[model samples]
Target: MLIDIFHDTVCPWCRIGKKHLFDALAKWQEQEVHIRWHPFLLDDTVPAEGYEFRNFMQNRKGIKAEELQHLFDYTQREGEAAGVKLDFEKIRLAVNTKLAHQLIALAPTNIKNDVVEAIYRAYFEEGLNIGDINVIVAIGTAYQMNATELKLQLNDRDVVDAVVAESAFARLNGINSVPFFIMNNQVKVNGSHSVEVFLEALNSTALLDIPAKI
Candidate 1:
């Protein structure tokens, strides 16, 4: 089965959703599955250097202090339930994830999933600024990708355009949220649903023409 996931690295729900998807897959009994990660920028207007997390939320997102606290508390509780530890305090910057998405697009198929996970952990867990070119290069090197080659690809216009186009296509298709999952390009699962919900979607998709491998 093929799973195409549209998500952003900065999205707390996306990270939690990924964890739930893994949990669902673990109990699926199907051993063979292919996943394709797609790009979706939550805020395309963020500058390359990025903004302080609190300022971004307050000024750009219009989130007041109490509302922000409520969001943090809610997401942290939800993350814990999904087996993901999200330290909102550790996150200092709200960055432009275009380059990070480009890196994922450039990743080799075998390591694409690893690259996505690493980016998410780097930003949400470690609080690294994934928008930085050097940081992105460092991540690629750590994942066994050639740093020089990856850096060059990251600066390529064609690569940037391709990822941008993907985001645009998603928006055109009425997908305005992150962590959207499409099963075999047919079944659409939106938001951070529970493991049981994902399992049900998977089971339903299996009944389609392409029987899921079990």
Candidate 2:
């Protein structure tokens, strides 16, 4: 079965959701699973250089410093429960994910999933600016991808267009959230759902035998 996952690299929730879904899959030994990761930009308007993290979050969420801390604390605790680490303080900027998405889109099939996971870690854990070409090239290099080639491809107008277009298509289809999942192109699951929810979806007949019409 094919599991289409729409996500953004900077989204900590997507990391948690991925962990939970994979945990569920570990327990489910029934069918072969193929995961296809797609891009969903959290804020495409973020400039190429990006914004200061704290200030941007404060303005974006309309909260004061203490309130921002509260939000971060809550998210951190949730991440802990899901076995994912979120180092918000280490993040200096809230960057546009366009360049990162391009890298993922052009990655070799065998290493594409790994590239996505590493990009998430780079942003949420290491707090690197994924929007920067140098940062992306470093990550790609770890996966044995040719750095010079990867850099060129990431800047390729065609590749950038495809990556951004995928995000646009998701919005047009009414999917405005990240970490959204489509099981066998039949069952649609949204948000950072629980392992149980994922398991149930995996077992459902709609995804197994009777696929619902798209």
Candidate 3:
């Protein structure tokens, strides 16, 4: 089955969704799955470099006083339950996710998934500034990607244009949020969901009857 996922690197909820989906994938090793990560910027209007995530959340979500405490508490507990370590305090910013998304788009097929997971871990768990070029290069280097070449490609006009086009396509397709999963090009599963939901989708007639290995 093919799963087209639209998500942003800085989205905590997206991380939760990925954790749940991965859990389901691990359980269904016999089932062949092809995953594609698509670009979806939460704040594309932001500058090339992003803004501080804490302030962005505070202003955007308007969580103050007791509400803020409750929100964090709930998120932390939920993250723990999902097996994702979310270090919100260490998170400094939520810069433009376009660059990160672009990386995912251009990554070679063999390592694209690993690259996506690495960036997610860097932002959500390690609390690193994912907006910076150096940080991105560091992550890419771990996968033996050419950091110098990546720096050049990061701002390549063609790459930027392609990413922008993808973003516009996503918007036109009615994607209003991150972590949106379009299963088998038919069912749209929005937001984070339990492993059961993924399992059910995979077991449906749409995805069943995998061709036997030769």
lDDT of each: 0.89, 0.88, 0.80
The TM-score measured for candidate 3 stands at 0.90
Report the error of model 2 at residue 151, Å. Answer: 1.1
* Best-to-worst ranking by lDDT: 1, 2, 3
Q: What is the per-residue lDDT of model 2 for residues 1-116, given as tens digits with 9 covering 90 to 100?
A: 78899999888889989988988899996777778888998898999999999999999989999999999999888889988889888899999999998888878889998998
**C-alpha RMSD of candidate 1:** 2.1
Residue 119 lDDT in candidate 2: 92
lDDT of 3: 0.80
Model 1: CA > 4 A from native:
211-214
The predictions' CA RMSDs to the true structure, in order, are 2.1, 2.0, 2.9
Q: Of 1 and 2, which scores higher on lDDT?
A: 1
Highest lDDT scorer:
1
Which residue pairs clash in candidate 3? 50-95, 53-93
Q: Give the distance in Å from residue 101's predicted Cα in candidate 1 to where it truly belongs.
A: 0.7
- Compared with the true structure, what per-residue lDDT tens digits does model 3 show for residues 1-214? 7778888898878888988888988986755678888888778777756686666777888877567667877887888998988787777777877778767876888999899989989987788877777888888878888888998998798988888788789999899888898766776778889888877766662555544222
Worst ten in a row by lDDT for model 3: 205-214
- At residue 208, candidate 3 shows an lDDT of 54
